[model samples]
Target: MYEHSSTHPADPTTPADHPAAPDGNALTRQSPFRRTVLRRVLPAVAAAGIGVAGFAGFAHGSEGGRAAAATALSRDTAPGSALTARAASVRQAAAADFPTWGTRWVVHASADVNSPAVGLINKSAAGQDRITADYQVDTGHQVCEGSACSTFMAHLTGPVTGFLTVVAVDIPQDRLPGVPVHGGGQPQPGGSRQEMLDRAATWLTADNGSQVPYSQAKVWKDGYRQDCSGYASMALGLPTPGTNTVGLATDRSITRPVSLGELKPGDLLIDAAGDNNNRHVVIFEKWNNDAHSSYTAYEQRGGHGTDHRTLTYGLPGGDAEFKPYRPVKFGD
Candidate 1:
């Protein structure tokens, strides 16, 4: 299961507060200018050897060596092996592109283009190497270049059953987006409150503008568990596969307890004391009334995948286990 248990099961009925699901056709419709740009850019991306097959020899080796490597990559169909080979290829590409840079390059990946990058490859020796390698797979796409070349997007497949566009980028440790430029403060993960909400909104219509299904046992294409905590982690810019409900509640580096009256957009209401099947968390969006008796929140529940609805989980007459927590990423 996705580490969350909801009192409400997945239901077909849409709540009054739930935003209508997007129209699939309308979502796919692109402006002529966008289409023209894609046509011009895709060829360049392919020529740059950005795909899995291309990456096999993208950075190193002679023609024959490249062909052999590509063939070996093709033969190794296992997801874990493929991800390792791909990560190695990315590392090699980074090394070749920026040879003077040290081995301290950390690679962040996001399956969603709008979402913040999660730490896929850490600068420290103790990073998650092949974290979601065995999950699912999706084809690769070039999401950045030139001015925005800090990140590259690709795809993966697995148990979670969704296409993963692995957005991997080789960013220097000190140069990471949220890092303190003068090296005086702790590095914060990237994303403003609006950006975080925007990231959470992506999953609502992730599948061609449709809600990503819930899965406690699997992760969504974005590599987040399709559960309350996983969704919260994605919103907060935490590492992929996400921290558990307990971790979200207790980890000072990630979040700290706050009074209900202090709740703001992007804060969490977490019930972390119970087992996975009983634990849950929700993203507090805003109070429905100044009275603070009811508020709107984003949740990834058992039956309904991603939902934005009015909830009183932590209010006076609400579920007592739920507590307000301000994500530490927001800073004091």
Candidate 2:
């Protein structure tokens, strides 16, 4: 499903997993700015007795005032309210109750991932919306936010694949600063976050068994000897091939420093020792929860080609010496 122009690589530091936030949002919920996770099995807010009129007013008034509450309450429980049928459609993209690999789906956005959204961002805004968000799944229809509504349906439609849960977050609402949002909520196989994971899983579980060893300065498309940084580069679609663990931390185009609180899937975390040949780096996958204790990662190190592993949070004593970073660009 993915077309990697280059190849996937690995990390140089730890031999474990990375970090990701799982802020759940399907079509609608309250608390817009909190860390979010778009879920396949969404919570029914109808029980809350929130009204849609309030959200419609919020959407219109906030655009003019630009002071939409950091914690906007959910629009009332109207099927016709903001989190409409389309949002529900996106919420059901999972093959099962949660997101996982192999679930199938589609993505529809207002505009392409490269475009800018001035207004009327998404009708597909599902789950609890956040300014900075990322989307993932096993397979199913997934709708992410963009400048415009990519789907012509004016309704729910992002046929999923491999996983469920469409991430349709609207960014830059009036005075809100433009934060990092996922590409038009759809399956962009050319080079998308989900595609990157799909490609990595291919190697991890090939029919003939392709995933092999971890090689420093190695870029073999053949048997795929992905090192730690190499695996990171390939999965993220970076221009560099043999970028080592040190290069990942130092290279600007590849990544920029960020806080551990803002960590997302595909982000990076270098150890306290800093970037270098011997020091290490790992691609953040996802955290267990808001506690930031345990997490998953993707990398190739310790002679392993490439793998999805788990690790604990914190410094040597498990307190977190994370020199966290985010990818500047994955693919166009």
Candidate 3:
């Protein structure tokens, strides 16, 4: 549903792990200095606009009943305008192709680190643009200052191995083992940010041995293999296809940007160097006594694996020079 966008300015001067924001509405600190929550609300509109249940054989049925020939999602189009409707159906199909929230997909890409799959998806969406001016390709979740489609896909590199599909917010019980379960099952109920965060914590089973595996599901038999954005994506249930450090915290539908001192326990630390390779993201564990003196975080690194490290402010190594953001639940 997205490429990449410059939602944040890149500041690669530092490369160190650091503490996270605290929990609750405004970042609460007991210090003498003033406290203020960075205030901004942006909702993540679905690029995954259509759902699978809506897909089917809707083409070639004549202008009377044909819907989308691509995915078969149901259409609301009235007859006598099938040509216009056919193009709209394709756009809907592209939207339906996305995975649900809290659900991850093992994307298969032909080029760059799993980026070809994204291009394929985007290309399909953009192809519909030939239908008319109203149609557009996979416009990423509204985080960029301009059109999400053109701006986000402008920068593309890497393979799809490390990718995790993020989708819209979902229920808490959906976080249970093998939830949003494939095939028919009783629909899982959703939860708030706390519930999703708690569920993500359960995946940190092999803290000592866990590595940031590209295909976490495949390699996860040994342990939960996760990358930084994958962990945050799961924790927030930001809807699939998922986003990278570049879009993680800034996705309008899921979170709002915040200053570092205003961070909460479930907030995120993102250092998006305007590029996915140079970018890194982490989840803030908590503030020690709300003093802002020291803190801990959960992250997936290259050699060390997924770790919960205690870090002080102003450390180096791509962890500093970052910004904090609050999940939607906390902000609402």
Candidate 4:
């Protein structure tokens, strides 16, 4: 998972929130621009480079495994070989240590908001070089100043919160609620971006409040807190763990990064600045024009704890661009 504490560059007004691009093109009026749909494709080659299942118990196991281990101890821990060995050991140890559904464990460090937001530690993924402990904060009545506000704000409300879950555990910006944004607080069946977005919108209506998960849909100013990628992950109903990446729309914390061309409907587009980041997550309605025309990016903004609008934005502008990273789809 990516860290949120790193400094982000200044944002160049986006078409999603702003009406036009820096080039004087009326982004709000354009139609069918180049649209990228991010989907849960297979794990990238780099993901495979890291071990996926179980801890390392092969040290005293099979014949071939033992010889490989001996070679590893002798050699300077070869690339793939050392990684595999280390992953295996981690898997075994983790399995024995934490007997749970998921092999991953979420460890937290004690943090004080008044103090700085650094110096915490954690155990990194097996065979990996770093540790992976996250910070845990109990939201009290006090309100935080900026993005750290989530820790001070109340549980989020609105259609977005219902289909919500913390995608990035490593750098926990907000205490992600384990509720579905659309499917009545439970995990809904996966489907196309339109399907998910439609479901969420439908549930967002005042009449459907009874059917959705949240107690009410009123904008709770502090009810929910999310950056761009966090909003996208919640809207898509993707697992919290799978939404880890390094750069682009998600801040590398929400859903893991995928091929830019593989953009999906209801995908998140983000540009972060010093204190806050500009975010836009919408459904990729269709691909139109000769790849130069405007595309539809549907999103629900502002109406968070207030009456907001779910509008469509034109794409491929300063706020929108292709971000390619080692794709790691979120799931078990």
Q: List per-candidate RMSD values in Å.
A: 15.8, 18.5, 20.4, 22.4
* Residue 314, candidate 3: alpha-carbon lDDT: 29
Which numbered prediction scores highest in lDDT against the true structure?
1
- Off by more than 4 A, model 2: 1-191, 222-225, 272-277, 313-316, 319-322, 330-332
- Candidate 2, run of 10 with poorest lDDT: 73-82
Candidates 3 and 4, the one with greater lDDT: 3
Error of 3 at 36 (Å): 61
Error of 2 at 270 (Å): 2.2
For candidate 4, the per-residue lDDT at 322 reads 28
Ten contiguous residues minimizing lDDT sum, candidate 1: 67-76
The per-model lDDT (C-alpha) reads 0.45, 0.36, 0.34, 0.25
What's model 4's lDDT at 222? Answer: 15
Please provide, for model 3 over 135-154, each residue's C-alpha lDDT reduced to its tens digit, 9 standing for 90 to 100.
Answer: 22121222111111110111
lDDT of 4 by residue, 7-80 (tens): 22112232112111211100121112200111112122221211121211001121122111100000000011
What would the per-residue lDDT of candidate 2 be over residues 143-261, giving only the tens digit for each residue?
A: 33222111211222222211111233232121112111222222232444554554344445322354535555444332122455555654554432335555667778667887777
Worst 10 residues of 4 by lDDT: 70-79
Instruction: Give the C-alpha lDDT of model 1.
Output: 0.45
TM-score of each: 0.52, 0.39, 0.39, 0.30
* Candidate 1 local Cα displacement, residue 28, angstroms: 27
Q: What global local distance difference test value does model 2 have? A: 0.36
